[model samples]
Target: MPICVYWGEDDFAIEKAVALLRDRVLDPMWTSFNYTSFPPEQADAAIQGLNQVMTPTFGAGGRLVWLINNTLCQHCPDNVLAELLRTLPIIPENSFLLLTSRNKPDERLKSTKLLKQFATEFREFPLIPPWKTELLVQSVNQAALAADVKLTSKTAQLLAESVGNDTRLLYNEIEKLRLYAEGSNKPLDVATVTQLVRNTTQNSLQLAAAIRTGDTAKALGTLADLINASEPGLRIIATLIGQFRTWLWVKIMIESGERNQQAIASAADIGNPKRIYFLQQEIKFLSVEQLISCLPLLLELEISLKQGASEITILQTKVIELCQICRGS
Candidate 1:
C-alpha cells in the first residue's frame, strides 16, 4: 500500500514524479489494466479515483490510481470528502494512490488533513525562485542528468537564466541541446546553448520590458518574432494580461505598506519570493490604475483575435498603443 501525495506549483516535477512512480510500481505489460489517471476539475474525479483504488490488481504488478488535480482539497463536498477519508485507508495492499495538485493543499479542508496524515510519502515541488541562481543551476544540472547529457555549471546557469522558472521549457531546451550536441561528444557550453535555445519565455519578458521602457522598435521586433514563430495571439495576450495583473498586485501591496518580498509573493501567489524584487522594479514606472487599464486593452485584443481579426496586425497595433501608454504619450 504505497500511498503518495505530491503537490506544488512545479507541475513538470509533479508530472515526472507521477511517471517515475508509475514505472516503479506498475508493470508495463499490465499498465493498461491496472493504471488509471484522473485530471483536474472533473466533477467525479475524486470518487472515480477512489473507486479505482478500491479495485484489486488483476495481474502481477501493483495497481496505481493517479489523481492529477485532487479537487477534494478545495471543491469536493464535505460528505464526499469524508467518504474519501474513510475509503482511502482501506485501499488494497497491492494498490497505490497518487494525488497531485499544482496548488498547495488548503489546510482548512478535512480531506487535505486526512491525506497528509495517511500518505506514506508526501513530496512538495515548489517553484524555485528566479533570483535563486544556484537552485536554478542545480535544476538545470538535474535536468541534464535526466536527459542523459552533460552541461557545464556555467552553461546550466545561463540556460536557467534564459528560461526563468518554467521547468517544462527548461527541460525542452535541455533536450534540444542534447540533440544538438549528440554527435560532437561535447558538454553543452554557454555559446552552444545561447546559439541553440530560442528562450520564448525570455522573449515574453523582453516584450514587456520593452513596452514599459518605451522601446517601440524592440517591442515590435519581439512581437514579430513571436508572431512568425506561430505563437498563438490569445496566448500572447494572456501572458501579458497575467503580467499586468501581477504588476497591479505589486502596486496595491506596496501601497498598503507591504514591503516584505515574501509577503508580496504570498499575495501574488508567486512561487519565488525573490521574484518580488524584479516585480517591484518592473512596476516602479507604472501605477495601479495604469495596470488596470492595460487589462481591458488586452482583453479587447483577445476578443478581437477570437473574432477573426488579423493576429499579427492586431498584436502590432496593441503593442504600439501600450508603448505609448507606458510612455504617457
Candidate 2:
C-alpha cells in the first residue's frame, strides 16, 4: 500500500494499524533513515510530510512517512492542500505516505477526491456503537490473545460492559488483567473483574440512574464507592452534570416531536441510540423543570468543593438534595 490512509476515532486501533504498516514497510535496520511521523498540528506538517515521503530511501527497504491526525483534506491551509494535491499522485512505489485522522475527510475537497481513487487503501476505524456488545467482547478477546492471556467469553462480556467502548482503556484493562493472571492457569473471571476494574464511568452512570430514580441510598452508596476509590470530586460532579444535561436535551427534543433515535442520539451526543430507551424510562417520573435545574445546583456543588468544602459532605448533600427534588418533596 503506497498511500495508506488509516483514519479513525479509536486511537488505539489507529496506532496498531500504523505500527503494522511500519513493520510491513520499513526495514528495522534502516528505520532511522526510512521512517518519519508527522503530527498534523506541527507547523508545515502537510508540506514537510509530503516532501519527506517523496524522498527515496537511503539504503535498502521501503520508506514510510506517517502523518498522524492529518487534517489536510479538511482543515489544512490552502498552500499545504495545494502542495499535497500536486504531490500525492506522484508518490514513488517504494515511498509510502500514511495519513490518519480522527475524523472522516471532507469528500468535497480536491485532496479527498484524489484519495478516493485509492479507496482500497483507505481504512476507517470508527468507534463501535454503544449497543454493539458482541463487537466489544471480540475486541477484548483479541487483545487478550495478543498478550498471551486467556479471557473467557463470559469474562470478556463482563469486562466489556465495565469498560464500555473506549479502546485505549480496554487495552489498558486487558494488560492489567494479563499481569494479574500471569502465573495462574485459570482464565480471567468475573470475580477478578469485580475486584480489579475500577469502572468509574459506569459507576457514575449508576449514580445518575440512582438519582433519576429517587433512590437516595443507592446514589449515596455509588458516590461513596467512587470517592473511596479515589475518583476526583470534580469528575464526579462533571459526570452528573453531563447526565442531567443529556436528560434535559432528550426530554425537550421528545416534546418537540423528535422521535428518531438516531437524531436524538446525535443531538445529545449519546454514543448508543439504544440507551435512549433506558434514558426515556429513567426520566419518565421526573419533570423537565427538574432536569433543567440540575446543572446550576451541580455547579454550586462544584464551587463548594473548589472552595475547600469536604467533598464527602458536598457530594452527599447534593445527592440528597437532588433525590428530594426528583421525588418532588
Candidate 3:
C-alpha cells in the first residue's frame, strides 16, 4: 500500500494527485525532513529513489521519496531492476515510494510487471483527445465539483468547448468562475461562462471543422488566431492529421457497409460508440476519395513545417488547398 505508480500525458493532473498524496501521507510538521525527490535529470534516479524509500523515517512522520519523470517502467537497466526487486518488497512500513512518468509503462517489460505485482496504487492520467466532447464535459463537471463551483450542464459544455483538453486552463477557469459565483445562489450559467472565460474557441479543432465545411476564409482566420495565440504549427498539423484520419476511417467503414456502430467506433479508435452517429452526419457529404486525399497534404504540411519553412505562410497555403479539396474543386 506504500508504493504508488502514476503515469500519463496529463502532467497537471498527476502533479495535483501527487501533492494530495503527499499531504495525506506526510505530517505537515515534519515534511521537510521526511520528503525527498529525484528529478529525471539526476543520474541513477531510480536506484537512488529505491534506496531513499527503503530508509526509515527521520522524526515525526512517514517518509516519501518521489521519482519524477521516472523511466524505469519503460527501460530499466539490470542494476536498477535488481535494486527495485530487492527494495520494493521490503520497503519500510513508515515510508512511501512514488514514481511518476508521462509515458505509459510497457506492460511487456519486467520492470512494469514487477510494479504491477507490488504497487499498491497505479493510475493513468491520460489527456482526453480534443474531439471527445462528452469526456471533456465530464472533466469540467468533476473539476467544478472539486472546486465547489456549481455549473449548469450547458455551462459545463461551453467551458469544455472553450478549454478543450487543457486541464490546467480548465481548472483555472473553474476557479475563476467559483470566485465570481461566491456570493451568488444560482449555479453559473452559459452567459456567465461566455463573459468570464477567455474565448479560446479558436483552436486546431475549429480549423479542422472549417476545412471540412470548405470554408477557406474561416479556416484562415482561425489559423491566424491560433498562430497569434502562439500555438505551435506542428502541434496544429498533428491535430488536423488525427482529425482527418478519424474522418477517413469513419467514411471508409460506412461505405464498406459496416452497420455496427461499435464496429465503426472500434475501427476508428473512437472511445464512445455513441459518437459514431455524429461523425457519420459530419462526413455524410464528403467522399472517401476527398478524405483519402487529405492525408498526403497534411503530411506535406508537417514536413514543410519541420523543414524550417515559414509557419504562417505554409499553413495559410495548405489550409486553402485543403479547403479547395473539401469543396471538390
Candidate 4:
C-alpha cells in the first residue's frame, strides 16, 4: 500500500490536504500536528522518532497528528520501510499519521505493502498553474469555505490576484478580511482587497503598491527583504523595469483595439492568459513616469550597493526615496 502523498506544485492543494488530515487526527484539546523528517541516511533516527510518536502519553491529552515531511524513503535496502510495514498493524488509534512528501516509493514497497490498510485516509495533492486566476479564486473560496466564511466570486478573484502564488500570505490575508467583513456591507473588490491584503515584504509590485499608497515605511521594508533574499539591486531594478515595459506594451496593445483576452495575452507574450486578463484591467492605474523613475534609481542603487557603502542601508534609502518620489512627497 502506498503512503498517502499530497504531491502538488500548487501549494494550496498540498496545504489543504495537510490541513484536513491535521484536523482529523489532532484533538483540539490536547495537541496539534507534530512533524519529523528523514534524509536517506537518517533512517535509524527517523525510525526512532516515529516510534516515539506511537508511544502512549501518561498524562491526559488529545490526539497528536504526525506529519513525515521529508525527501527520503524511510525504508532502505535493508527493509526499513518493510519493517515500517510490519509496525503499521500496531500503530495506536490515539495518534494520526500523515505523510506529505514528493518522492516515489520503491515498487516492492507498493507491490507487497499493506500501508494503506492502516491509514484512515490517503490522497495526493494537485498542482495549479501559477497564472490560473480562476482556479486561484476557487482555491481561496475552498479555504474560506473550510473556515465557514463566505466570499463572492469577484472578491475571490481580487484576493487571488493580489495574493498571487503565496498560499501562506493568502491564508493570512483571508483571516484579516474575515474579521473586517463581520458586519460591514462592503464587499471584497479590488480596492478593498488592496487595503486588506497588504504585502508584508517588498517585491516589484509591493514597491509599486507602496508607491501607489504613499507608504514609505513599507516600501523601505520591501527593499530590506529583497536585499535579505540575496536579490541584487540591479536585478530588482531590471525586474521592475521589465514589469513597467510589459505594462507599457500591454497598454499599447490595448490601444490597438485588442479587446479579447486571448489576443491581449498573446500580444503581451503572457504565458498565462488568466494573468493577462486581469493585467488588462490594471494597466490603466500606472503612469509611465513611475516606471521611468524606478529604473534610474535602481541603476544607482546597483552601483552604490556593490562599491560605496553598507549595501543594505543604501538600498533601503534608495527605495524609500523612490517611494517618496512616486508618491509626490
The list of candidate 2 runs beyond 4 A from truth reads 127-135, 145-148, 152-154, 182-185, 198-202, 217-329
In angstroms, give how far residue 195 of model 2 lies from its true place: 3.3
Predict model 2's lDDT versus the native.
0.80
Query: Each prediction's TM-score against the native?
Result: 0.65, 0.67, 0.91, 0.50
1-329 per-residue lDDT for model 4 (tens digits): 11344444456667767676556655555552343333434556546645755766433443343445543233444454665666667766665445555554443655224444555555555544333445667778877776555677777876766665567777878888888777765555666666767643345555555654557888777767767766556555555555555665676777777777777777766666667756666656555565566667766776775686777677677767767666762
Q: How accurate locally, in lDDT, is each candidate? A: 0.80, 0.80, 0.91, 0.59
- TM-score for predicted model 1 compared with the true structure: 0.65
Q: Using TM-score as the measure, what is the rank order of every candidate, best first?
A: 3, 2, 1, 4
Which candidate's lDDT is highest? Answer: 3
Give candidate 3's TM-score: 0.91
6-70 in candidate 2: lDDT tens per residue?
A: 77778888888888889998888999999998885788887898899889898888999988787
After superposition, which runs of candidate 4 have C-alpha atoms over 4 Å from their true positions? 1-43, 57-67, 71-75, 102-114, 147-150, 199-329
Model 1 backbone overlap count: 0
Backbone clashes counted, model 4: 4
**lDDT per residue, candidate 3, 116-157, as tens digits?**
998999999998877767788899999999989998889998
